[model samples]
Target: MPSLPTIVLVDDAAEVRSLVRLQLRLAGLGEVVGEGADGRDAVVLAAQWSPDVMLLDVSMPDLDGLGALPQVLEASPRTRVVMYSGFTDPALAEEAVRRGAVSFVQKSTDLDALVGEVRRLLPGEQPAAAPDAVPGAEDHDPRAAARELEQHVERFAGVFDDAAIGMATLTLQGRLVRANSALARVLGRESADVVGNHYPEVVRSGGDADGRLTAALERATRGDDDVVEVEHRYRGSHLRTTFSPVRDQRGRPLYVFAQCQDVTRQRQAEDQLRQAERRFRLLVEAVEDYAIFMLDPTGHIASWNSGAQRSKGWTAEEIVGQHFRVFYPVEVARSGHPEHELMLALRDGSYHEEGWRVRRDGSRFWAHVTITAVHDEEGHHIGFAKVTRDNSERHRLLEEQERYARALAEANERLERANHQLAAAAEDQAQFLAVTAHELRTPVSVLSMSGRTLGEHWRELDESERDEILEGMETSSARLQRLLGDLLTTSRIQASTLDLRLEDVELAAALAPTVDELRRVHVGAELRLEVEAGTRVRADPGRLAQVIENLVANAVKHGAPPITIRALAVEHSVEIEVRDAGEGVPVELLPRLFERFTSRGAGGTGLGLHIVRELSRAQGGDAWYDPVRTAFVVRLPASGPP
Candidate 1:
């Protein structure tokens, strides 16, 4: 039995060390002659123990397995180290390969694969090959030599006339002695015709007199070089021809062997690939505003050409294999936007959006992006291809323009409303001024005309005429006084300064005085007052008198002569109605009759009825017109507790 090879086990954990040692023992690989807890320990232990194979963990507290690999190799040149770690980081795997680590495994890798790796790295292990001892050797023991010669013959015959490339043999003088079927076919001749032909007869150009064939043949024959391949033309067709010299026992050149291969398809495919690459480069350059790139299956950037770097401000080295979340802002990153988008794309085959993305310096830019899932020919999703464009400037301009439009619309609406209010105010002011002037002018003209008449007719006037003139003067003076009183009362009412002197009084008592005043002012109207004598109400005296007087005046001036004032006691109030036997007010004007300046007659200030209504309301009473009876009614509180 062969001696057992020594093995070294290195791991950061003690359990993995025992587990691997047990497995290796069961597999009969070797005994664990050395152990290490870290990459540095592995390196030191390997130098001291000089084991046949060193197994090291790729990750450790100090130096990683990959980092310590070169030191271990330098320390013990013959020791073979195998790397293992829980990390699936491809960069680490690639680095392990680069540093000449013989094997790599994840911690949870299949036990069979782990055993296979350990066995492959074991020293003094030979591959299963043909046995060195030949069959039927017996006492002569020449069978091994005979078998080696047979193998050489079999290999030489097996490749001599391969189909893909044609082979043939020629003499030193360039005469063809033998040819394979493929070579005959290439020359457009039968084998019999090509076998005895010379190179000059077969080649369109006379045998490369440039001495290339001669030099190749000389090197092979003198054992200087084994084989030579030259690109030459035969029958005006390009051919890759290989030359080797066949020699005798004394190493003298017997024949020059040549093989020809057709490379047209391969060269054409290469040219097509080059053209495709050129078009791809042009396409990438033409898209100036977009960052287009590719990602590996694990969402790491795989390809970042010039266009991507220019648009995103990321160099190829900075972004490749790093998570795409680097492009998202911190808020977006924490929300897992980049990962969510990738998942959606993987499920749906695409994702598209426009939003803000962060740059390396932490500034933001608006981006329009399209992510398309990349797949193999069989439709298995392999990765993602992303195209992003910086649309920050255009987005900003559009938002600014929309805001301007909204502002302009608001300004126009405000201006229109202001113009309308100004027009309305102008009309109201003009109406008020015209009405005021007319009311004043009529009174002043009456007083002036009466005075002038008295002055002119004093000598001619008898006692009766003088009395009438004096009475006319008195009437005009009373009218002027009434006008002034109404004006002052309206002003007080508008300013909310009118004070009420409340008292309990009979409703009839209030109406009697106003009726007498109305008859004295105009004897033409026939007025009558009827009331329940003892029916009383609680109200302001001056204000109640003003209400009755205004109603009586309204009827006398605007209605026919006969007027009747009636009073009654209802459940909680006394109602006084002033009725006129006259043409009823126009139905259209009834709704606004009690409003200020809404009287029918020109002599009426119109404030009389408005004041009447407002005074009644102020005394905890109300006034309303009864259109059915051509009557206006005033209702006051009864003399009782509310």
Candidate 2:
């Protein structure tokens, strides 16, 4: 018992393959070795199985049986190709035989009667290239067969001459013996001009084509290589040329047969695609405000862009290959937040968020981040594409705005309460105007008179007289400046625009200047300070000074002196009192004294006491008149030096 002849069946229809496979097996003529659905698989099957016989369909997707026939023969030279199809046209059989099939069998043919035919066409020694004869040439007379062979050779020669691709035959010594019109056109010359020139020189229009190609051609001519292919420039067009050596029966190399194709369009298209990809990559890498990059599967950083380097302070060389967790806070990474983001992206296709992200310098930024799961054509998750934008400035601005809003609301609440309490006294604002004019008049008159006296008396007065006049002017100027400052502060306090820098302010140290200034201005009055040692309050120093100044002015303008400034350190707060030895504010006026425009005497603008109360409250404290002690008191939150 001999081994069964092996067979491969190919068809677009599965039923046809099954029917043929079963019939061949039932006939006991061969064993079914492989199956294919189309011409692409037919070539692969030929290469893999090298079956005794291959039954190939005439038509299939991607490549047809007729198209795959030569490739099949090239892949498995010893195996026989039997063209199989539903159509019974005799011309199909003739065409198949011309392209190197051993036989053509219609599907309608009875398998019982075809076993002997299949056996006759099994594996056998054959030429490596396609056969030259048409089907049925063996059945004709010798002269008729000779004529048929001549016609076949003539038809092949015509195909060679008129083919779209360039074809030429060259002597093994490298001379072009013949070239098709297509070859001549590819070389940018007449057919006659291209036919006799050395192939490489003809390709470049005169110069030697390239050293590597010359070597390849030499190797092909020497039979050292079975096939040689190269891509090179020719006549300003890109081309790919293949060289194959024709050999005699004893395996001696003859002339070299070559095929050339004008791949200029394809090459140009490929170059354009590569350039577009390069430009896109550069664009992604150059962006600086947004960090755009890629991560591999399992969350390792695969690419880093310029924005990532700029914002996160990590160069691509340092960050790439590290895990994406490197961009997250240590606690966040430990909590598996980065991995959670990856998982969420995988589940949802994309994840977007705005939150804090860590930087290389240990600083943090408010980052708007997006992570998108990336997939290949087959839809397998490969990695993630991440984009992060630094939004720290915007975040900070939003917070500051919220703080201002809260401050405004608090100011409005306090203003509302004060308006309710002072509703009956709204008519008193008219008196406030009168008080401002009268207070403003005193300083303006003193300045005008002092200037006149100084101008006239400079030559007439002695040194003591001149000094006393200038002192009067300086005191009036200081008083005028303090009044203007009070006015501006009132405007800012009402506008809610006043800003403060709070710190541990020592009451004694901070008040020394204001007390000395008062001593100079009120030269005959006794002004004293009693500050407990190391006493401090939590307040803005400049604002605290304003509060003290207003209280002192209130005592001097309304109550009488000697004025006493005292600081007392309490358990959770500190107290500062401005007192005068004169009779205290009347009981009836005391209730309305802290109101913005309530007046005690004609000498004051009535804003000093209100400002004192408001400024103290703004620094987390309050002010009031302690009638029993005959003192105007400010109580502020206590503090210790840091």
Candidate 3:
């Protein structure tokens, strides 16, 4: 159920909701994750699940759909709202779309058409319901099939006058003998004005299209088995019209029934999706640094990019249909590690590691692999995007370094820095390798070189030179400590194990320790903290300080000093703003600035801002990067007197 496209059904009438649910289930259109009786419930359900489509009733008690339209969208921005009503007024339909609904659907529409409208808003192919009963020739009485067809048509006719889609009966000569009010509204005319016109004339297509439709109508009269699908333009609406002919037991031609649905918006959406898919396909095929491919939900290979072909030594044609487990070593496959990786990706959004992977030629290479779960806009977990880069050379060098460090461990106290850095990897080495390999490597190199320099040339170095090297060592050590703290906190947060003891905390005092530490470490940078008296917040004191320190460190690392930290009381909350006078975060990275492993192309573990946000939220607050002000802001529920 979690892998299904979800929908929220909202209506004041329980009967309407129940019937729609039945239709949706019968069509396998989507899962109704939530149901609501009024406009306020619509907003709450939208916020809770962020379903793909919302069927909103136009009239409800307390707050109507029109009033809830903006709120529901604000709560869940991806939800496509469809206004449902019993009225067929064009003005109301126009207003609903004007207020952000994707479409307006009349409640009187046949349930099948309503199902289609909902299906149109969601992306992907839908499963169609099989016909419940169809008379066979063996069992057919002369009137049996005809009676069955008429019974279906009779049911359709009951809703013909009020259905949202355009329905018409045309003569064998392609003339419209009848038109419904909905079709008339689409044509900007009354039903009386639209009827009795040539279908081609009413549609207003060019000569070529008219001739094609006329021929199609002539063919449609010959058999009921063929369906002629055509697009017709009237006013500004693009109607997707389908002509189905009715026949008797002897197969004599009968009137052609046409169903026309406005498909202008759907066509535009499909065009945009095609363009995006083309661009993405081009991008994927052009990447050659790693093997990037997609696996189906059940782990069968779905797509193979050029990078996959180059690195894995198999062309797309040879590899696209194989199971993704083929890339794993035989022992690993037998151990169920491939399935485990996929399970981890689905459960945690991604799985990353360094391990051996088999090539098509049966050779093994150490690979750094990341398998990320891909979800559609409807929040359905569709597949996994796996990226694998050959890291054999790096792994070999790391092994050599470890061996050399182990050999020299007892020789000199001066080699202590390298040993300490190596010891840092004794725990959670896989995690450290995945997240901060580059970051940790640089700092380790600095400390190693500084130790070797002093050890090899103690007599040649003067007092000032020795002090500068020692200061560099101090800075690198502090950096490693901070990165480790961030890693631990991030792990706790991601595992949902972080404990917060929240209370009234004075803003100025909580920040004093962090400020002193930064000032002492960065003597050349100016750091200012400003807060009005009596400013306080309801937050965990330790986590609050950690959040503040991380933001200041970001400013110090990524922006130019002087940096300022200001806490201001506003209404029932207190906002702590940390700002620097440097250029703000780039527009592209701003949207994902707080995401894990998101970097600004600067140095440090990418977990700082992510941890800051998580810690703030854990204590009933939130954090954001304000690109316009070049500041990182944290807002928390306020406490104490104003």
Candidate 4:
């Protein structure tokens, strides 16, 4: 006899390697020299053993068979490699052939054929036919046919038991005829327990009696070409099932082939994604301060939000589908600044600048604009997301601050010269102290009168009268407290002692109590609050409350009734606005609204707005005025959850 060819087997599944080894030995076709469980080990074994032939599985963990093919051959140049796998694809076979694999065989091929192929590739091995046997003898022999069937059944059994995915075969009556270990584990039962049980009945007992599986089985068994698939929930587990019919020669169904996968985690992830999308949509729609919108590839407005309507003064129905350049001032639009911004965003992925934009009424306001490019998975530019905020008030305040700095420098220089005239300066300072004292005496006098009235006629006064007296006293007390706070805050500013204890605070929780207190203090003014829940800010809660109280109190004292307090969450910040239903402040006073002692009405020390702005700036935020709405708006750093 010719020398037996030595072979090595490589497969991820130990059972598969063992079966192939046993079949080769039983057929007396070759001698097994070594075995490996993955492609990396196969390369080392092939080089060590120097086998005549190597049977390598195509799909293995770490490095696949194709990836290892060139390396294996380079290591053992004399070894002829045969790529084998349960999955047969022409593309993979072609790739294997190109990579120096002598042949490709499906694991489902008959054992006799597989042995013959391996023998033919081995050195000095030639298959011979006996003189008594005619051509195609096995095709006509009953024994040969029976043996072939047995071998096929064995191969199938090996593959089914070792499959990584859950698989089963059911009879026409819906009874389980066979099940793999994977399927048994998915159902949390033994293979024997699942073999004879009805599949639909088992599913029903598992608390997922949706009848979908049964319907799928019925449809598949009716000689339909469509594969049936459905997601089923059973006993807190999510199963994705697919059903296909196994047909006989005449296209009549014989069995139902089914595959089940546990998709519970996948379903949960999808639900979370949907909920996040919903929250994002609500956040986009709820914003009313900044213009947040989308643009197409060519810079046309694709979508708009309520904030876009309020800021740009163009409703969605009118603005959408129009060029974003419409919002730019006439001169800026003519200069192609909008198009230039889009080009910059496309090139660098984002662009931001402060420029002039036009509202619908033809008025121009300074705006801070940002444009960001949006892309798909392949990095193809799809569109752009644009955000614009009315920064005119901020620009004005910056100019004022520069002027104030210059004036302070001049004053310091003058004081150096005025040290010689200290007596004259002392008189002016004394007069200033007297004016401050007079401002304090007003609220104190009101509080004393209200307290005396409530104490002297507690029972004699009617309920409405008593309530009015109590509200007046509370208002006066709040007034005094505000004055003292302002004085302290001013002193701290001069001494640079103002500090903040920044923390994550829910805007609604912080503002609700302030609104309630405002209603009690201003009983005659109708106070309405509209605030979004779960809006958080990074700021000191006590200082934030004081800012809100001062704004609302100013509305009550200067503006008319029906004052509205609105709070909205924007990108990177939270905005709170206090609006009243009255004619707005004089345009002349708007520029100096936040100046110290700048009051348009009586009973104010002109420090309320000034203190509000100072406190906001210390917390990495700022305060501004919306002259159109007569609203004082405060923007603060948002403390969104990490």
Which 10-residue window of candidate 3 scores lowest in summed lDDT?
Answer: 425-434
Models sorted by TM-score, best on top? 1, 3, 2, 4
Weakest 10 consecutive residues of candidate 2 by summed lDDT: 125-134
lDDT of 3: 0.72
Error of 4 at 450 (Å): 6.7
Collision pairs in model 3: none
lDDT of 1 by residue, 416-524 (tens): 7996996454333333332443344323433443343334334544686557546655765676677777878888987899977888886777767777877887787
Each prediction's TM-score versus the true structure? 0.35, 0.33, 0.34, 0.32
lDDT by residue (tens digit), candidate 3, 1-642: 347789999986564575577557655788899999778999999999999999998755455677788899999999999887644546566667877999988664244456778888778846464443332423533234334434533453456667676776654545454567777776666766545456777666423354555566666765433357667555666666667653321233334567667788977877997999899767745768678888999999999877788788999889887888899999999999999999999999999888889999999998988899999999998999988877765567557855986776655465666657753432233223323533443344345444444443445556876687677667667877888898899889978999899988888887888899889877767999898767889989888888888888788778899999998777899989999989878887777789765556554556889998999889988999876777889999999853
> At residue 567, what lDDT does model 3 achieve?
87
State the lDDT of candidate 2 residue by residue for 1-642, as single tens digits.
778778888886553464455445434567888999778899999999999888887645445677789999999998888886533435456667878988877543233324446766655422223224433445533344334434543464576678777877665655564567887777777766554356776665633446656877888788675467777876578877777654432344545777777889977878997999899767746767778999998999999877888889999999999998988878888999899998999999999887778898899888888899999999998999999878875567546856997997999799879867753332232233323433443344344444443442345456866686576667667766876777788879889988989999877888899889877766666788989768889999998888877777667666677889998876799889889988888888777888765555443445788888889889999999888999988999999775
Which residue pairs does candidate 1 place in steric collision?
none
lDDT of 3 at 364: 94
lDDT scores in order: 0.67, 0.71, 0.72, 0.73
CA RMSD per model (angstroms): 56.6, 50.1, 34.2, 38.6
